[model samples]
Target: MKEKLVVFSGAGMSAESGINTFRDSNGLWEKYDIYEIATPEAWNKNPELVTDFYNQRRKNILNVKVNQAHLEIAKMENLFEVTVITQNIDNLHERAGSSNVVHLHGNITLAKSSGPNPEKKYYPIKSWRLTKNDLCEDGYRLRPHVVWFGETVPMLMEAQNIIEQADYFLVIGTSLQVYPAAGLVHHAIKAKKKLILDPKVSEMQVPNDFLKIEMTATSGIIEALDLMR
Candidate 1:
Protein backbone atom coordinates (compact mmCIF):
# COMPACT_ATOMS: atom_id res chain seq x y z
CA MET A 1 0.00 0.00 0.00
CA LYS A 2 1.21 3.53 -0.75
CA GLU A 3 2.07 5.73 2.20
CA LYS A 4 0.01 8.80 2.87
CA LEU A 5 1.58 12.20 2.12
CA VAL A 6 -0.09 15.31 3.48
CA VAL A 7 1.13 18.64 2.07
CA PHE A 8 0.11 21.83 3.84
CA SER A 9 0.66 24.85 1.60
CA GLY A 10 0.22 28.60 2.06
CA ALA A 11 0.46 31.86 0.07
CA GLY A 12 4.14 31.53 -0.85
CA MET A 13 3.37 28.31 -2.71
CA SER A 14 1.56 30.31 -5.36
CA ALA A 15 3.71 33.44 -5.19
CA GLU A 16 5.90 32.12 -8.00
CA SER A 17 2.81 31.87 -10.15
CA GLY A 18 2.31 35.65 -9.63
CA ILE A 19 -0.31 35.35 -6.85
CA ASN A 20 0.29 37.89 -4.10
CA THR A 21 1.17 36.72 -0.61
CA PHE A 22 -0.86 38.30 2.19
CA ARG A 23 1.64 38.97 5.01
CA ASP A 24 4.82 39.33 3.03
CA SER A 25 6.47 42.66 2.29
CA ASN A 26 4.58 44.70 -0.35
CA GLY A 27 1.75 42.18 -0.26
CA LEU A 28 -1.91 42.89 -0.76
CA TRP A 29 -2.32 43.93 2.90
CA GLU A 30 0.09 46.81 2.31
CA LYS A 31 -2.19 48.24 -0.37
CA TYR A 32 -5.63 47.41 1.06
CA ASP A 33 -6.92 47.56 4.58
CA ILE A 34 -7.95 44.12 5.78
CA TYR A 35 -10.91 45.51 7.70
CA GLU A 36 -12.16 47.20 4.56
CA ILE A 37 -11.69 44.29 2.20
CA ALA A 38 -11.34 40.94 4.00
CA THR A 39 -13.68 41.04 6.93
CA PRO A 40 -17.33 40.03 7.30
CA GLU A 41 -18.04 43.57 8.42
CA ALA A 42 -16.50 44.78 5.18
CA TRP A 43 -18.98 42.78 3.14
CA ASN A 44 -21.86 44.04 5.29
CA LYS A 45 -20.71 47.63 4.98
CA ASN A 46 -20.00 47.59 1.23
CA PRO A 47 -20.72 44.34 -0.55
CA GLU A 48 -19.86 45.82 -3.92
CA LEU A 49 -16.33 46.72 -2.86
CA VAL A 50 -15.80 43.29 -1.33
CA THR A 51 -17.22 41.64 -4.44
CA ASP A 52 -14.99 43.65 -6.74
CA PHE A 53 -11.88 42.86 -4.70
CA TYR A 54 -12.45 39.13 -5.01
CA ASN A 55 -13.51 39.46 -8.64
CA GLN A 56 -10.16 41.00 -9.51
CA ARG A 57 -8.40 38.28 -7.53
CA ARG A 58 -10.37 35.66 -9.46
CA LYS A 59 -9.41 37.29 -12.74
CA ASN A 60 -5.74 37.22 -11.71
CA ILE A 61 -5.96 33.54 -10.82
CA LEU A 62 -7.42 32.75 -14.21
CA ASN A 63 -4.61 34.59 -15.95
CA VAL A 64 -1.74 32.92 -14.08
CA LYS A 65 -0.49 29.36 -14.54
CA VAL A 66 0.59 26.93 -11.83
CA ASN A 67 4.33 26.97 -11.09
CA GLN A 68 6.91 24.17 -10.88
CA ALA A 69 6.22 23.58 -7.19
CA HIS A 70 2.58 22.81 -7.91
CA LEU A 71 3.55 20.45 -10.73
CA GLU A 72 6.11 18.63 -8.56
CA ILE A 73 3.60 18.16 -5.80
CA ALA A 74 1.10 16.75 -8.28
CA LYS A 75 3.70 14.36 -9.65
CA MET A 76 4.18 12.91 -6.15
CA GLU A 77 0.75 11.29 -6.51
CA ASN A 78 2.53 8.58 -8.50
CA LEU A 79 4.56 7.63 -5.41
CA PHE A 80 2.21 8.22 -2.51
CA GLU A 81 -1.39 8.88 -1.58
CA VAL A 82 -1.12 12.68 -1.58
CA THR A 83 -3.63 14.98 0.08
CA VAL A 84 -3.07 18.73 -0.31
CA ILE A 85 -4.42 20.92 2.46
CA THR A 86 -3.93 24.49 1.27
CA GLN A 87 -4.56 27.84 2.94
CA ASN A 88 -4.92 29.46 -0.48
CA ILE A 89 -8.27 29.95 -2.22
CA ASP A 90 -6.97 29.65 -5.78
CA ASN A 91 -7.54 26.63 -8.05
CA LEU A 92 -3.89 26.35 -9.20
CA HIS A 93 -3.40 23.06 -7.37
CA GLU A 94 -6.42 21.61 -9.13
CA ARG A 95 -5.23 23.07 -12.41
CA ALA A 96 -1.86 21.36 -11.81
CA GLY A 97 -3.65 17.98 -11.55
CA SER A 98 -3.53 17.40 -7.80
CA SER A 99 -6.66 15.24 -7.38
CA ASN A 100 -7.03 15.46 -3.60
CA VAL A 101 -7.09 19.00 -2.20
CA VAL A 102 -8.63 20.36 0.99
CA HIS A 103 -8.99 24.12 0.95
CA LEU A 104 -8.61 25.44 4.55
CA HIS A 105 -9.64 29.05 4.00
CA GLY A 106 -12.16 28.92 1.13
CA ASN A 107 -12.16 28.86 -2.67
CA ILE A 108 -12.44 32.22 -4.45
CA THR A 109 -13.57 30.54 -7.66
CA LEU A 110 -17.08 30.02 -6.23
CA ALA A 111 -19.73 32.08 -4.47
CA LYS A 112 -22.20 31.34 -1.68
CA SER A 113 -25.42 32.89 -0.53
CA SER A 114 -25.45 35.84 1.84
CA GLY A 115 -28.46 34.42 3.65
CA PRO A 116 -28.49 32.12 6.65
CA ASN A 117 -26.68 28.79 6.37
CA PRO A 118 -24.43 30.31 3.72
CA GLU A 119 -22.16 27.29 3.75
CA LYS A 120 -25.04 25.02 2.82
CA LYS A 121 -24.82 25.92 -0.86
CA TYR A 122 -22.17 27.18 -3.30
CA TYR A 123 -22.60 28.76 -6.74
CA PRO A 124 -19.94 28.71 -9.43
CA ILE A 125 -19.13 32.01 -11.09
CA LYS A 126 -18.94 31.52 -14.86
CA SER A 127 -16.52 34.43 -15.16
CA TRP A 128 -14.34 36.68 -13.02
CA ARG A 129 -17.13 39.08 -12.11
CA LEU A 130 -19.86 38.38 -9.51
CA THR A 131 -22.18 41.32 -9.32
CA LYS A 132 -24.91 42.27 -6.81
CA ASN A 133 -27.45 41.06 -9.35
CA ASP A 134 -26.03 37.57 -8.91
CA LEU A 135 -28.31 36.01 -6.34
CA CYS A 136 -28.47 32.51 -4.97
CA GLU A 137 -31.47 30.23 -5.25
CA ASP A 138 -32.82 31.67 -1.98
CA GLY A 139 -33.01 35.19 -3.46
CA TYR A 140 -30.09 36.44 -1.41
CA ARG A 141 -27.02 38.09 -2.91
CA LEU A 142 -24.12 35.81 -3.83
CA ARG A 143 -20.97 36.55 -1.87
CA PRO A 144 -17.43 35.32 -2.33
CA HIS A 145 -17.01 31.81 -0.90
CA VAL A 146 -14.24 32.84 1.42
CA VAL A 147 -13.71 32.44 5.15
CA TRP A 148 -13.49 36.08 6.05
CA PHE A 149 -11.98 37.42 9.27
CA GLY A 150 -14.16 36.59 12.32
CA GLU A 151 -15.56 33.60 10.43
CA THR A 152 -15.10 30.00 11.54
CA VAL A 153 -12.97 27.69 9.38
CA PRO A 154 -15.43 24.93 8.53
CA MET A 155 -12.79 22.48 7.21
CA LEU A 156 -10.37 22.67 10.13
CA MET A 157 -11.41 19.37 11.65
CA GLU A 158 -11.25 17.60 8.30
CA ALA A 159 -7.72 18.94 7.83
CA GLN A 160 -6.66 17.75 11.28
CA ASN A 161 -7.97 14.28 10.53
CA ILE A 162 -6.03 14.16 7.29
CA ILE A 163 -2.85 15.37 8.97
CA GLU A 164 -3.10 12.80 11.75
CA GLN A 165 -3.12 10.01 9.19
CA ALA A 166 -0.15 11.26 7.24
CA ASP A 167 3.01 9.18 7.05
CA TYR A 168 4.88 12.07 5.46
CA PHE A 169 3.92 15.60 6.37
CA LEU A 170 5.24 18.45 4.23
CA VAL A 171 4.69 22.07 5.09
CA ILE A 172 5.45 24.42 2.20
CA GLY A 173 5.51 28.21 1.90
CA THR A 174 3.68 28.85 5.19
CA SER A 175 5.11 30.92 8.02
CA LEU A 176 2.95 29.00 10.50
CA GLN A 177 1.56 32.30 11.78
CA VAL A 178 -2.15 31.79 11.11
CA TYR A 179 -4.19 30.13 13.76
CA PRO A 180 -6.25 26.92 13.69
CA ALA A 181 -4.64 26.15 10.33
CA ALA A 182 -1.15 26.56 11.78
CA GLY A 183 -2.10 24.38 14.73
CA LEU A 184 -2.97 21.55 12.35
CA VAL A 185 0.77 20.74 12.09
CA HIS A 186 0.71 19.48 15.68
CA HIS A 187 -1.70 16.73 14.63
CA ALA A 188 0.99 15.10 12.50
CA ILE A 189 2.57 13.29 15.46
CA LYS A 190 2.36 10.01 13.62
CA ALA A 191 4.22 11.24 10.57
CA LYS A 192 7.57 9.48 10.19
CA LYS A 193 9.08 12.50 8.50
CA LYS A 194 8.12 16.16 8.86
CA LEU A 195 9.58 18.70 6.47
CA ILE A 196 9.12 22.43 5.94
CA LEU A 197 10.10 24.06 2.65
CA ASP A 198 10.60 27.81 2.60
CA PRO A 199 13.31 30.37 1.96
CA LYS A 200 12.79 31.80 5.42
CA VAL A 201 12.61 28.46 7.19
CA SER A 202 15.49 29.29 9.49
CA GLU A 203 13.75 32.42 10.73
CA MET A 204 10.47 30.60 11.43
CA GLN A 205 9.75 28.79 14.68
CA VAL A 206 9.13 25.21 13.71
CA PRO A 207 9.86 22.05 15.72
CA ASN A 208 13.54 21.04 15.84
CA ASP A 209 12.78 17.66 14.30
CA PHE A 210 11.43 19.23 11.14
CA LEU A 211 13.91 19.31 8.25
CA LYS A 212 13.96 22.85 6.93
CA ILE A 213 14.91 23.67 3.35
CA GLU A 214 15.65 27.36 2.97
CA MET A 215 14.64 28.07 -0.61
CA THR A 216 11.69 29.36 -2.54
CA ALA A 217 8.82 26.93 -3.13
CA THR A 218 9.70 26.27 -6.76
CA SER A 219 13.30 25.31 -5.98
CA GLY A 220 12.59 23.93 -2.53
CA ILE A 221 10.03 21.44 -3.80
CA ILE A 222 12.59 19.91 -6.12
CA GLU A 223 15.01 19.28 -3.23
CA ALA A 224 12.10 18.03 -1.10
CA LEU A 225 11.13 15.50 -3.76
CA ASP A 226 14.72 14.37 -4.05
CA LEU A 227 14.90 13.73 -0.30
CA MET A 228 11.66 11.74 -0.45
CA ARG A 229 13.19 9.53 -3.14
Candidate 2:
Protein backbone atom coordinates (compact mmCIF):
# COMPACT_ATOMS: atom_id res chain seq x y z
CA MET A 1 0.00 0.00 0.00
CA LYS A 2 1.15 3.51 -0.71
CA GLU A 3 2.20 5.49 2.35
CA LYS A 4 -0.35 8.03 3.57
CA LEU A 5 1.03 11.52 3.10
CA VAL A 6 -1.17 14.21 4.59
CA VAL A 7 -0.35 17.79 3.63
CA PHE A 8 -1.72 20.73 5.59
CA SER A 9 -1.52 24.00 3.68
CA GLY A 10 -2.50 27.61 4.33
CA ALA A 11 -2.62 31.02 2.61
CA GLY A 12 1.14 31.01 2.14
CA MET A 13 0.89 27.97 -0.12
CA SER A 14 -1.07 30.05 -2.62
CA ALA A 15 0.75 33.34 -1.99
CA GLU A 16 3.29 32.63 -4.73
CA SER A 17 0.40 32.02 -7.11
CA GLY A 18 -0.49 35.72 -6.61
CA ILE A 19 -3.16 35.13 -3.97
CA ASN A 20 -2.62 37.65 -1.18
CA THR A 21 -1.97 36.39 2.33
CA PHE A 22 -4.12 38.12 4.95
CA ARG A 23 -1.47 38.63 7.61
CA ASP A 24 1.57 39.57 5.57
CA SER A 25 2.85 43.14 5.42
CA ASN A 26 0.71 45.19 2.98
CA GLY A 27 -1.48 42.14 2.58
CA LEU A 28 -5.26 41.94 2.25
CA TRP A 29 -5.77 42.86 5.90
CA GLU A 30 -3.91 46.10 5.34
CA LYS A 31 -6.40 47.10 2.69
CA TYR A 32 -9.56 45.79 4.32
CA ASP A 33 -10.66 45.46 7.90
CA ILE A 34 -11.20 41.83 8.93
CA TYR A 35 -14.33 42.77 10.86
CA GLU A 36 -15.80 44.53 7.85
CA ILE A 37 -15.05 41.81 5.31
CA ALA A 38 -14.71 38.43 7.04
CA THR A 39 -17.20 38.23 9.81
CA PRO A 40 -20.76 36.93 10.15
CA GLU A 41 -21.84 40.26 11.60
CA ALA A 42 -20.55 42.07 8.55
CA TRP A 43 -22.53 39.82 6.25
CA ASN A 44 -25.66 40.47 8.29
CA LYS A 45 -25.11 44.22 8.15
CA ASN A 46 -24.10 44.53 4.49
CA PRO A 47 -24.57 41.34 2.52
CA GLU A 48 -23.89 43.14 -0.75
CA LEU A 49 -20.44 44.24 0.31
CA VAL A 50 -19.64 40.75 1.59
CA THR A 51 -20.93 39.17 -1.60
CA ASP A 52 -18.98 41.57 -3.79
CA PHE A 53 -15.83 41.01 -1.79
CA TYR A 54 -15.90 37.26 -2.32
CA ASN A 55 -16.89 37.70 -5.95
CA GLN A 56 -13.68 39.64 -6.55
CA ARG A 57 -11.68 36.99 -4.71
CA ARG A 58 -13.21 34.31 -6.86
CA LYS A 59 -12.30 36.31 -9.95
CA ASN A 60 -8.77 36.59 -8.65
CA ILE A 61 -8.59 32.82 -8.30
CA LEU A 62 -9.82 32.43 -11.86
CA ASN A 63 -7.05 34.70 -13.16
CA VAL A 64 -4.19 33.05 -11.23
CA LYS A 65 -2.60 29.81 -12.35
CA VAL A 66 -1.44 27.05 -10.05
CA ASN A 67 2.21 27.54 -9.14
CA GLN A 68 5.11 25.06 -8.99
CA ALA A 69 4.47 24.37 -5.32
CA HIS A 70 0.94 23.22 -6.09
CA LEU A 71 2.09 21.07 -8.98
CA GLU A 72 4.82 19.48 -6.87
CA ILE A 73 2.33 18.53 -4.18
CA ALA A 74 -0.02 17.05 -6.78
CA LYS A 75 2.78 14.96 -8.27
CA MET A 76 3.32 13.30 -4.92
CA GLU A 77 -0.02 11.50 -5.38
CA ASN A 78 1.81 9.12 -7.70
CA LEU A 79 4.09 8.07 -4.84
CA PHE A 80 1.75 8.19 -1.89
CA GLU A 81 -1.86 8.32 -0.80
CA VAL A 82 -1.90 12.09 -0.75
CA THR A 83 -4.69 13.94 1.05
CA VAL A 84 -4.46 17.71 1.11
CA ILE A 85 -5.90 19.65 4.03
CA THR A 86 -5.84 23.30 3.09
CA GLN A 87 -6.95 26.46 4.87
CA ASN A 88 -7.15 28.28 1.57
CA ILE A 89 -10.43 28.75 -0.26
CA ASP A 90 -9.05 28.49 -3.78
CA ASN A 91 -9.38 25.52 -6.12
CA LEU A 92 -5.74 25.54 -7.28
CA HIS A 93 -4.93 22.22 -5.61
CA GLU A 94 -7.70 20.48 -7.51
CA ARG A 95 -6.74 22.35 -10.65
CA ALA A 96 -3.18 21.07 -10.20
CA GLY A 97 -4.60 17.51 -10.03
CA SER A 98 -4.44 16.59 -6.38
CA SER A 99 -7.13 13.87 -6.03
CA ASN A 100 -8.04 14.28 -2.38
CA VAL A 101 -8.44 17.65 -0.69
CA VAL A 102 -10.12 18.91 2.45
CA HIS A 103 -10.69 22.62 2.73
CA LEU A 104 -10.53 23.63 6.37
CA HIS A 105 -11.70 27.20 5.82
CA GLY A 106 -13.89 26.52 2.75
CA ASN A 107 -13.73 27.06 -1.03
CA ILE A 108 -14.31 30.49 -2.50
CA THR A 109 -15.33 29.09 -5.88
CA LEU A 110 -18.53 27.72 -4.43
CA ALA A 111 -21.63 29.18 -2.80
CA LYS A 112 -23.89 27.97 -0.02
CA SER A 113 -27.32 28.88 1.20
CA SER A 114 -27.52 31.71 3.71
CA GLY A 115 -30.12 29.58 5.48
CA PRO A 116 -29.51 28.01 8.86
CA ASN A 117 -27.97 24.85 7.43
CA PRO A 118 -25.46 26.32 5.04
CA GLU A 119 -23.57 23.04 4.92
CA LYS A 120 -26.49 21.13 3.48
CA LYS A 121 -25.44 21.80 -0.09
CA TYR A 122 -22.78 23.74 -2.00
CA TYR A 123 -23.50 25.36 -5.34
CA PRO A 124 -20.64 25.97 -7.76
CA ILE A 125 -20.40 29.57 -8.89
CA LYS A 126 -20.37 29.32 -12.70
CA SER A 127 -18.07 32.30 -13.40
CA TRP A 128 -16.82 33.86 -10.17
CA ARG A 129 -19.86 36.10 -10.01
CA LEU A 130 -22.29 35.29 -7.24
CA THR A 131 -24.75 38.12 -6.96
CA LYS A 132 -27.54 38.92 -4.48
CA ASN A 133 -29.97 37.58 -7.06
CA ASP A 134 -28.39 34.15 -6.67
CA LEU A 135 -30.46 32.00 -4.37
CA CYS A 136 -30.37 28.40 -3.22
CA GLU A 137 -33.23 25.95 -3.68
CA ASP A 138 -34.42 26.82 -0.20
CA GLY A 139 -35.06 30.40 -1.34
CA TYR A 140 -32.31 32.06 0.64
CA ARG A 141 -29.50 34.21 -0.73
CA LEU A 142 -26.32 32.41 -1.77
CA ARG A 143 -23.23 33.34 0.19
CA PRO A 144 -19.58 32.56 -0.23
CA HIS A 145 -18.79 29.10 1.13
CA VAL A 146 -15.83 30.39 3.12
CA VAL A 147 -15.76 29.97 6.90
CA TRP A 148 -15.77 33.45 8.29
CA PHE A 149 -14.46 34.51 11.68
CA GLY A 150 -16.77 33.55 14.62
CA GLU A 151 -17.90 30.61 12.53
CA THR A 152 -17.23 27.01 13.43
CA VAL A 153 -14.93 25.05 11.14
CA PRO A 154 -17.09 22.13 10.09
CA MET A 155 -14.19 20.14 8.58
CA LEU A 156 -11.87 20.31 11.56
CA MET A 157 -12.74 16.87 12.96
CA GLU A 158 -12.31 15.16 9.62
CA ALA A 159 -8.90 16.84 9.23
CA GLN A 160 -7.82 15.65 12.64
CA ASN A 161 -8.83 12.10 11.77
CA ILE A 162 -6.80 12.22 8.58
CA ILE A 163 -3.77 13.66 10.35
CA GLU A 164 -3.87 11.01 13.06
CA GLN A 165 -3.37 8.29 10.46
CA ALA A 166 -0.72 9.96 8.38
CA ASP A 167 2.58 8.24 7.70
CA TYR A 168 4.11 11.57 6.74
CA PHE A 169 2.66 14.93 7.70
CA LEU A 170 3.72 17.98 5.71
CA VAL A 171 2.80 21.53 6.69
CA ILE A 172 3.38 24.20 4.06
CA GLY A 173 3.10 27.99 3.90
CA THR A 174 1.14 28.31 7.16
CA SER A 175 2.04 30.59 10.04
CA LEU A 176 0.22 28.19 12.38
CA GLN A 177 -1.44 31.23 13.91
CA VAL A 178 -5.02 30.27 13.20
CA TYR A 179 -6.85 28.38 15.85
CA PRO A 180 -8.45 24.95 15.63
CA ALA A 181 -6.68 24.59 12.27
CA ALA A 182 -3.27 25.34 13.76
CA GLY A 183 -3.93 22.83 16.51
CA LEU A 184 -4.21 20.09 13.85
CA VAL A 185 -0.46 19.37 13.90
CA HIS A 186 -0.85 17.91 17.36
CA HIS A 187 -3.10 15.17 15.99
CA ALA A 188 -0.26 13.78 13.84
CA ILE A 189 1.31 11.92 16.75
CA LYS A 190 1.32 8.71 14.73
CA ALA A 191 3.09 10.25 11.77
CA LYS A 192 6.60 8.87 11.33
CA LYS A 193 7.82 12.17 9.95
CA LYS A 194 6.60 15.74 10.27
CA LEU A 195 7.92 18.72 8.37
CA ILE A 196 6.98 22.35 7.81
CA LEU A 197 8.07 24.38 4.76
CA ASP A 198 7.94 28.14 5.00
CA PRO A 199 10.22 31.19 4.73
CA LYS A 200 9.29 32.38 8.21
CA VAL A 201 9.81 29.12 10.05
CA SER A 202 12.01 30.71 12.67
CA GLU A 203 9.10 32.75 13.97
CA MET A 204 6.85 29.71 14.37
CA GLN A 205 6.50 27.77 17.58
CA VAL A 206 5.98 24.19 16.49
CA PRO A 207 6.59 20.88 18.21
CA ASN A 208 10.26 19.96 18.55
CA ASP A 209 9.96 16.91 16.30
CA PHE A 210 9.08 18.91 13.18
CA LEU A 211 11.85 19.34 10.59
CA LYS A 212 11.62 22.98 9.56
CA ILE A 213 12.63 23.98 6.06
CA GLU A 214 12.98 27.76 5.98
CA MET A 215 12.32 28.60 2.35
CA THR A 216 9.51 29.85 0.14
CA ALA A 217 6.89 27.26 -0.81
CA THR A 218 8.11 26.82 -4.40
CA SER A 219 11.74 26.17 -3.47
CA GLY A 220 10.97 24.60 -0.12
CA ILE A 221 8.65 21.93 -1.50
CA ILE A 222 11.40 20.74 -3.88
CA GLU A 223 13.86 20.49 -1.05
CA ALA A 224 11.28 18.76 1.14
CA LEU A 225 10.58 16.13 -1.55
CA ASP A 226 14.32 15.46 -1.93
CA LEU A 227 14.74 15.02 1.80
CA MET A 228 11.75 12.68 1.96
CA ARG A 229 13.24 10.57 -0.81
Compared with the true structure, all predictions reach lDDT values of 0.93, 0.93
Candidate 1 residue-wise lDDT at 127: 94
- With a 3 Å backbone cut-off (N, CA, C), the pairs that clash in candidate 2 are none
TM-scores for all candidates? 0.98, 0.99
Residues 56-123, candidate 2: write the lDDT tens digits: 89999999999999999999988999999999999999999999999999999889999898999999
Q: Give the worst 10-residue stretch by lDDT in candidate 1.
A: 220-229
TM match of model 1 to true structure:
0.98
Segments of candidate 1 deviating more than 4 angstroms: none
Q: lDDT tens string, model 1, 118-185?
A: 99988889999999899999999999999998899999999999999999999999889989789988
lDDT of 2 at 155: 98
Name the regions of candidate 2 deviating beyond 4 angstroms.
none
